[model samples]
Target: MKSPSRTILIGGTLSAALTAPVVAAAAPATMDVTITIPQLKVAEYHRPYVAIWVEKAGTPPKTVAVWYDDDMQKNEGTKWLRDVRQWWRASGRTMKFPANGISGATRAPGAQKISFSRAQLGATAAGEYTLVIEAAREVGGRELLRIPFSWPAKAGAGGRAAGKTELGAVTIAFR
Candidate 1:
């Protein structure tokens, strides 16, 4: 037989051990993503709508972020977002408009930084994944860029990809 105090201590320790994994999984680290949209010399140039997402083997792509014209009247701006063909077919059409944390106005020609936590990524398991960025402009061409990296990334792990006309440079860094 055990003393009442000893029994209480043992029960508390067991409870902590059982809940440790759940707590750890819920705690997510930060990932920084930088996207650069180049200023093109053209007859008419419009800010490009961009979509960023992550894809893993045998799984459908998951949207991490999307940039489009959020200032249009009556939310009509979203109608043209389908021009980002790949993202639209993959995961865009199914989602409701103006998604929190994932939707924003189109950015100007420059590097834009966005951050995401593991919880925001939605069940990001440790494995290989691809970061895909696609951009389409009004009266301009479309471009898609992809960078592959591992999840639960190691220190000093990062990669960059560039597009010829629409996109400038895209980079991902894990701390």
Candidate 2:
């Protein structure tokens, strides 16, 4: 009864692309992702606002995967990410409440699973893609976690790694 050693795979610089570059015809696929915010040394777990998205290498169009509820009035969970400037601007700052996918509810320090379909994903190729996770603590600062995951959006039901600063562990699956 021994546990496996988990490693953090950090690659890709999707965040660099804030403008979201347009790409060729992307293969229609679905990406089932799980976001986990590991325990932090700090108190007051105000439920961090997390943003997940995919981006094309050397480009501008970075597809938004999942952005926490940004509706301040309706969801205070979102306003917390102002520190996560990147996501704040890309998504949170929008304050429009995730249009379709999951509801805008603050998640505790645990696993939050969600799935995205091709219908939802505009256009992306199935060659090489990046999985970007941005976590913004309520009282804490922000941290960016990057993982270069090849797509169809679905290859192996594996995860990248958890960021020590903000996220604990992050997993993305095809099933």
Model 2 TM: 0.64
Q: State the lDDT of candidate 2 residue by residue for 1-175, as single tens digits.
A: 0011011101111321233433212322445667777777665666676777666656543445445545567656444456667755654555455444433455677787666554333324555666678877676767888776665553447456777777877777653
Clashing pairs in 2: 20-60, 20-61, 20-62, 21-60, 21-61, 26-124, 38-168, 53-65
Task: Report per-prediction Cα RMSD to one decimal.
Answer: 11.1, 11.4
lDDT of 2: 0.56
Error of 1 at 102 (Å): 0.7
- lDDT tens digits by residue: candidate 1, 1-175: 1144235435544554577856434432556788999989999988999999888888878898899988899999998989999999999999988886578889999999876554445426888888899999999999999998776665454789989999988887764
Runs in model 2 with CA error above 4 Å?
1-28, 62-81, 89-98, 153-155
Cα lDDT of all candidates, in order?
Answer: 0.79, 0.56
Number of the top candidate by TM-score? 1
Clashing pairs in 1: none
